[model samples]
Structures are given as C-alpha cells and as structure tokens.
Target: MYKSPLALMVSLSTLAQYAAAAGFIDDSQLTLSLRNNHFTTDNRESRGKIGNAAYTGQNKEWGQAFVLSYASGYTLGVVGFGIDALGQLGVRLDGGGKAGKAGVSRTPGQLFPLESDNSAVDDYAKLGLTGKARFAKSELRVGTLQPKLPVLLSNDGRLLPQTYEGYQLTSKDIKNLTLVGGLIEHAVGRSSTNDTGLAVNGGTRQSNKFTYAGGDWAVTPALTAQYYYGKLEDYYVQHFVGLTHVLPIANDQSLKTDLRYFRTSADGANDTAAGRAEGYAGAGYASTTGKIDSRVWSAAFTYTLGSHTLMVGQQQLSGGSGFYQVAQNSLPNEGAGPGSYYLLTDRQVSSFIRAGERTRFAQYSYDFAGLGVPGLSASMIYLKGDEIRTANGPDQHEWERDIALDYVVQGGPLKGVTFSVRQASLRSGAVSDLDQTRLLVNYKLRLL
Candidate 1:
C-alpha cells in the first residue's frame, strides 16, 4: 500500500532515529535481473475436451522479464523493523498457444494475459511488498510472502514467480531448530496477473484461508528431521514428515538420503458427500466422491563423487486419491495453478502424483568444471509411473525424460550471464503424449 514516495520516505525516516541507524542503511540491497525465456511444446495427441482445435495442437511463446528486488536491513533495536519489495514486468515476444489445453472453455495460451479479442497483452507489471519486525531471534513478516517450506512451495517456473498474500513468522529462538508458521489468503499464478482464491485441482469453489505450521530440527551435523502441517479452510488437512542424512564416504565422495511422507484427508465442506457434490472437491480418482483422502511417501538417495552426482528416488500414492496440494483451477483458462510441489518428481512435465500411482525416478548431473570447463553443467532426469488409479479404466501408466544443459559467462562484460537449454518428453495413458523445450538467458545487476 505504500506506493507513493512520501509514504516510503516516511517509513524509512523512522529507522534512522532507532537504535542502529548504520545497520538500516548499510545492509540495504538493490538488484535487477533480466530473464529471457522461449518455450515450445508439441502435443502428440488430443482432440480437445471441448471438441475444438482451439485447445489442442502445438504451443510456442517467448517473453522477456525484468525483475527488481530490494531488501532493507532491520533497524538495530529491541524490535527491528525492515521492508522488502519486488517489482516485475513481462513483455510478450512471440507465440500464443499454451502447452496444456484442457477444460471446457479454452482461452489463449498461458504465457501472457489475453486482450478483449483473445490476443496476448503487449506487457504487464506487478509489485509486491513486505513489512517485517524482528524480536530476538524471531522475525514476523506481513504482506506479500514466498514460502519455501515443506508445506508450501512458491513456484518460479515461468517468466515470473508465483507469490502469496499473507503473513509469516519464523523463529530460531530454539537451538538446533527452526520454527515457521504462516497464514496465506490468496495466490498469484505463474501466468496470471490477478490474484485468486485457493482451491484444489478440479475444485469449482474457492477458499481464501490457508494455514500452516512447521519446524526443522538438526538432529546432528549429518542428519536433520522435519515435520509440517497445513490446512485449507473447508477443503483438506495435510501433514508431512521428512528426514535427511548425509555420510562422508571419502575425502571427495559422499552419500545423502532423504525420506518424505504426507497424509491428507477431507475437512469441513469436503468432509461430507453432499458438500463434494456442491463443488468442494479434488482432482483425479477419488474413492469418496470428491473428497480428499490420500497418503504419499517417497525416498531418495544421492551419491556424489568429484563433479558427478547421481540421485534415485521412488514415490507411491495410496488411499484412492491423488496427492493434495494448493492448486487454483476452479476458473477457466488458468495455467497449472499456483506452482510446483516439493517433490523429487516435480519436473518440467508431468508431476507423477496421480492417485494410486507408483513412481520410480533417477537423475545424473555433471559439473563441467571438473573437465576444466567452468560455468558449464548438464543433467538428465527420467521418471516412470504406473498403477495409476482410474474410476472407469483398469489402470494407467506414464513416463517422462528430461535433459538440460547450462553455461554461464565466466569473465568479461558478460560475466555472470547464464544460458540454459532444457528438453522434456513424456509418454502417458492419462492426458497426452508430449515433447517440451525451454531456452533461457539471464543476467543480474547489483545496483547497491
């Protein structure tokens, strides 16, 4: 709300007279980033759910984005105060159609907002602000928030990033442990300029309130454990637990293991069959009408040697329901809702979290620096999921493979600039077979 120069200056003036004026001014940061993205996708199958070509076929789009970020240092005092700001602008470059064209009424692609005649907007902009206060080892932030906890994962897969409107409190008051809690009211999708209420996939209704609490404990220098709980008002209640451990196999070799589990069930409106028929429901195969009831678990292990890293994982979903996460698809012409879930299987294409699905995945990445080529890297990921539950069908299966290459300017004027190329292919019996590719160029500037 403090958009005017006068309001911002007033807020800044209050910091000087506080306990530590130097801390407030000395620790401030301002940065600018330019990101160029080109996306292309090919759908090997589809006649459109609405029985039209508008929602099927190939999709290609390009865009340029400018992101400005600023973080102010807290005033040195018993209760420190600070502020954060994010400003973004997106310019359409080319293309109109989106990759996935589902639902009844299909709009234009997901890259940019559509005009009155279903044309892409030339440009769009957005702003975010956060006010914060710190006491001892705890900090409370109110306003725009981006949470990266187990319960909530902010998505940044598109030209811009997904953000939330709410307040969050984080504390390190306890030794060897970090505590976090937040209350979010709304979410902005990756390709959306407007903030919408929260809901599950296929949910026709929306809920504005989402609450979460969690903590991470460092059991030892090589081991950590985590637990988190989240609830969407009148939708579902979810719980998560995780463990991570690392062991040194040699001076230059190490192995790491990660385990995660989630339990979710219906609540409030979704608690009754009548409420589900009224529109409060989840996506995929649901044993109890439209209710949310599922349990998911995954375990992964990684081995690192010099510049080579290999990781393998498996995940399973049970209870006649798909994985539960905050997704807002109740509206028409929306992208894949909020963002990516915190799962090893969350990749460039399918997420592999279908109902009763069992997924096994693997990845291998290498750093070119080991071969005397600094700032270069490559990675390959593959995932296969089977035993997908369906209401009318016997069963289903799907698989995806992704390959990526990246390089960064090591020196000269273009130093710190990055170039990346990513390609993905998916084969499935659920939606459609597809191939996707993305190219990105990025540069960052430090203004302060």
Candidate 2:
C-alpha cells in the first residue's frame, strides 16, 4: 500500500518530538564542503528546425556550491534516537544569457534558475532534515535521503546532489545480508528550491508514491549479489538483479566482472492508451506515448595489473520502450530535471538507453602512482551504439568518446582538495553531434 506524503511527514515529526531526549547535542558531528564547477557544451548540429537549433549552439555556465551537514549519534537507550540535517547553497558566476540556457519549465537549467526572460538566476538554496532511529541491527530514517541503490540512484552530477523526501528502513540482522526498503514521496532536484512528484522519463503526469525494496547478499568472499524491486503509482514496476565478483590471479593482479539485468512493465494508468491519454505513460518514441515494456542487460569485465586497468562491456536493450527510470523533467512550471539510472552506458552526455539498442564500449585507465604521482589518474573510453528505434528512419546509430583526468592533494593544508576534468565527444544520427567539457574543484572541512 501507498502512504500519503503528508501522513509520512506528520508521523516523522511526531516521533522526533518524542525522541528529543538527552544526548542529542553531546554526540553530533558537523562538516562543510565546497565545490566549484564549470560546464561547457557545444552542439554541432545544423538542422533547420527551430526546436533542434535551440540546443545546437554553445552553452556554458560556472557555479559554486556550499554544503553543510550535521549527523547526531543515538541517544542512550535500548532503542536509540538521532537526527540529521543538511543545508546547501548554489551561486552562479557566469553563463546568464537567455539564448541557450536550458531553463525548461520541466527540465533543469545547467547551474541556475530560469528567470521570466529565460536567463539564469543569480543563486538558489535549500535546507533538509532527517529524523533517525536505530535498533540492534536495524535503522529507520525519514525525510531527506540520497539513495545510492542500483534501481533508483540519486543524481549528483551537478552543483548540488539530488535528494528525496521519504521513509527508509535498513536491516542487517542476518550475517552477510543487508535489507533495504523505502517509500519516497517527493524529489528535490540538483538545482531547485522546490520538491516535485515523480514520473518516468518523458512523462508529464506526476505520482506521489514510489515504493521500493531490495537486498544484498555476500555469498562468498569475492562474490556478492543484489536484487531490488521498485514501483511508481500509476506508472510502471521494475525489477533488477546484479552480480559482482573479483578473482585474484597474482600478487597484484585481479579480474573483476559485473553483471546487471532489469525487467520493466507498465502498471496502473500507463497500461493502455486510454490510461496514457490521462497523462501516465513514458515518452520518446514514434507516437510520443508508449507503455513501459523493456528488458535490459549489461556485463563488463576488468583486468588490473599494477597501476593499469582495461575494461570492456556490452549492453543490450530489447522491447518497444526504452529503459524505465524516474524523471521529473516534464513537470509543469518546474525548472529542475535530475534523474539517474544504473547502467554501464550512462555517461556524461547521453545515456544509451533507446529501444532496440545495442552498445559496445571499451575503457583504459592508468594510475600515476607508479610514476611517483600518487594522487593523479587518467582514463579514456569509447562506445558505439546501434539498432536504435526510430519512426522516420530504417535504423539509427551513435557513438561517443570520453576522457577524464583527476588529481587530489595527498597532504598539507589542502590535503582533501581535489581537481578533476572531463571531456566528451558524441556523434549520432538520432540527435546531434556535440562536445562537452567540465572542470571541478572540491574541498571538505571537518567542524566539530
């Protein structure tokens, strides 16, 4: 069954009021983090359509973010109580032009809000709190959550991390087994001040209830398995299974394999055309409204030797619809669109998730520690996708290349400071040819 957002919030508030006993202030930890981001994208498409050309030029933005967080230890008792709080602020430094800013009423702008004239806003800020309680081997948290599970990963690919308001429970009563479940009612985008309901990709209708459950089991020392199930009211239901294993070959060499599978189907109002007409269906197909039905699987293998690693993977999508993931980008009058899915092919620019698509990818990475630079690393990757579903074409195809470099201060006053850069080039028949770049600097401080 589904629970209303109001009911959940009220229940949490009531429990927190009663749990506010002693030790609340004695065992708390606070931290602050700062991040600077610069983003640039160049679209090389020259199509004649106005809508296509809107995103066909240079788009750039620079911003900074400050995150303050506090977590309290449990109170002294059989069943302990605690609370967590988070505050975030984002300020834009450049890229205020209204020509190419992504300020979609439903989708998000790059790093700021869209004004009435479609220009970027100066700044945005938000605050969140969570009340928590713990038993012997189980814990419950209600309110703002950044879930990192495979089925519904929280998006942190921007100035601020995406958050959700909900109720979540976790248990580790059985050895090597971890259980998790949650009821999510609302989502806070990576660059928004308000919360919105949830929906599938390309969907305009919103659903308030998102229920999920999952578990992870460590079957052996080098092998672990995962399974999860998620459902959005009136939209669709999905199931995921994953496996990971590592085998040591030599003193410093090993091979790792990761496998993931997902099955999704329409539910409730999205099951038929009449239901879809009422605003409950996935978009991005020939007809613009299609039922959710897909089966996707991906497997990747990595071999590491000393400071070098090489990886290769392939992902296949089969069905009439693409992969199903929650995306609130089309909500009315909302200027934030943040969504993420757990796929090997999900990259900086595009996610190779179109229907009837098959993607092949390869990557090479090197650690500079062997060369006396302990905190520096570099990697490059290439991916090609084919067999895309299209209405006007026989078949569509695309390819992408990505390069990344990162360095962190190993010691000194800036011990935790890090710098990173990423560049991507993509060419496709379905969309456009594009180039994107990102530069980031981050630092964290511990404040008791």
Candidate 3:
C-alpha cells in the first residue's frame, strides 16, 4: 500500500509532537573526519600506450577530503522517528589527466570528477539525508544508505565513500538473529556527486531496482550462519550462504573458519541473446557468452596466537562466469567508480576472481600492542590464482603481493588520528599488470 505525500506529512507531523524528549536529543551524535590521501599506480606492461606526456605510464593523485555525519536518536514512545545526514567534500591537490596523444587520451576521474574537457574538477561535494523510524527492535530507514552486506559492499577505497539511495529494514527482535531487507534504486559514486542507476561489470545499460533479503543466525556462541538472496531487475539473481565458526583454545589463542558460497544465474534481459546484444551482460572476460551463470565458493582459516595472526584461504569459480558485484564501472560516462567485493581473495591491485579460476592466499599480521606500541599494526599478504579460462587460448595464472602498515594515536589531543601505508604488486595474465601504493592520514573530531 502506498500513502499520498500529504498523508505522510500529516503522520510525520503527529509523530514529531510525541518525540521522546529525553532520548531524541540526548543520544544524538555529530562528527567530522578529515582525510589526506595520496595514490600512485604504475601500469607496468600496459604503460606508454598513450605516449603524450613524460609520465604516460604512471597515474598519481593527491587529494584531501572532509566528511561530516550526523545521527539523531530515535524519539521515545511506541514508535520513534529520527533523521540522519551526511556531507562530504573532496579537493584535488595534483594529478588530473592532462592532454594525451592524438587519438588515445586518458580520462580524468581517478579521485575527482571530470570537467567538460576531460580534466579533473578542483573539488566536488555531496549531501545525503535519511529519515528513519523504529519500533521495538526493528528499524526502517529511507533515502541515502551505505549498506555493507554480502550483496552490496559500499566502496570506501578512494578519497570518498560511495552512497546508495534506498530503503532498508532491519529487525533484531528474535534471539541472536538479525533480519535484513532492502530495495536500492540508485547510487552515488565514491568520487561523484551525480546519482546513477545500477549495473554490473562492463554493462552500460542500467537497472533501476535491486532488491535483497537476508538473515544471520547465531546457532551457538561460536558459530553463526547466514543466508541471503538478491535480484537485480532484468540483470541477474544471486543466492548466498555462509558459515563461520570459532574454536577457542586458550586465553591468547583461537582458530576461526569462514566458508562462503554463491550461486548466480541470468534473469530477465540477460537470459536472452538479443537483450545481451543491447548491453545487458557483464564483463566479457567473466562470461564468454555474456550471460550470467556462476558458482563461487571460498574457505578461510585463521589462527590467532598472542600478537601474531595467520590466515590462509582458497577460492574457486565454476560454471560459465566469474564472481561479480554491482556498480563496476557501470555508469555510462564515469570512469572506474568505487566498487568492493566481500571475498577473501579481494586484495589490493587484484581481486583474483576470474572465470574458472582457483586462488590460494595467505596472510601474516602482527599487533604492536604486545610490544608496548599500543596502536600500531603491520600485515603482509600473497595470493596466487591459476587455471583462469580464456576465450580461445590456454589457461593462464596470476599472482599478487601486498604489504600494509598502520598507526593510530592511542591518547592525548590527537587521539583519533591515524596514519596508514599500503603497497601492492600484481602480475596478472588476465587483468592489467600494475603496482599501486597508497598513503593516508585521518583524524576525526566530535562535533556534538
């Protein structure tokens, strides 16, 4: 049932009068975060294709970003109402794409929006508003959202974070259970202020409705199970299942096992060749026929002892396609916008997911707290993927290595300040061969 706009306004006005005086204003929060980020990439083998500038083979960008967030506590009473707001601004310091060779020009959308001449904009800003209602342990939110579910992993890898326009309902009334469902209509890119429709890998055509429902069940204190289903109108349908378990050994040691599986198939337009001819399919390398048919699975094991943690994992892709998520360069006129995959093998420079691929990965991490350095950490990871399917050639393989270091101020005036560095190298037979590095400094201040 749909209510008229006037009716909604009237109902909202009534609820405003009953706003829980104490809870609504007392628990509200406002914060502002400052981020300074620098990113550099070397195109390795794919370099020098555009030979106009001296630095044709490399891409570098430095930017500063500010994010302001506000959340109001729900009003008291049988039903509560609230509002949330987000504001973000990003300024480019250096490195927007300049003029390249005659016919081959580089696009300028790495960390900022592009101008009419394909140059990066000096700055860009975005604003979001959300209205929320609550009853018991369930809440409903409408408008801007950043959902971090298996089907929708909001991207925050760039100078800014991505946002989606949608309505979400989450309920936790049952014991040890969380139920989630939502409908998303549009999304704002990580570095874009424009809101655009949704699509998959290499698709140019957009879809307006993406719906999902899921639930997480905690069977035992150490075991949890998850199931989710998602459908992108006229694109594809996906089903996911996950299980996680933890085995406690001692006070300082434990083992964790994580397993995930997904099944995806073509829907509406993607089910027909004619529709795919009109740009209804995903990346061609992911599916030779441009149709969605995939089965993906992964298993990871982690061991924690003292300040040292080790993790090992493996992932496999079956059927005719590789694993894919929403909003992968799907916008018609946008460069590579931010999109994230919630896979164990999703690492810096490479996701390690391709058609008929098998990947094995490992990581070692150390916490400096044990060494009396309270808020410092370091980690290294390596991944190797093999047997990637090709259209008309033999199978290929690829590998990637990444190192990361982070430090955070534990106390004092600069308490919420952090510094991080990440470097990654990839040698891939499927994707681009590149080396990437990122440096970031972040500080957060409470405004209310």
Please give the range of 10 consecutive residues that has the lowest summed lDDT in model 1.
Answer: 46-55
- Candidate 3 stretches with Cα past 4 Å from truth are 1-23, 46-56, 98-109, 286-288, 336-338
Error in Å for residue 272 of model 1: 1.4
Give a tens-digit lDDT track for model 1, residues 296-412.
999999999999999999999999688878877565555535567888888998899889999999999999999999999999999999998887857888899999999999999
TM-score of the candidate numbered 3? 0.91
Q: What is the TM-score of each candidate against the true structure?
A: 0.90, 0.91, 0.91
- Ten residues in sequence with the least summed lDDT for candidate 3: 46-55
lDDT of 2 by residue, 1-448 (tens): 0023244334434443443444565676767789999988777763422225455457788899877777878987889988887777787887776344353122224777677777776777777889899999999999999998887899888898889999999999999999999999999888677799998776788899999999999999999999999999888899999999999999879999999999988889998788898778787662345788899999999999999999999999987788888878777777776578899999988899988889999999999999999999999999999988876656778899999999999999889799999999998877778888999999989775
Clashes of each: 0, 1, 1
Score residue 357 of candidate 3 by CA lDDT. 91
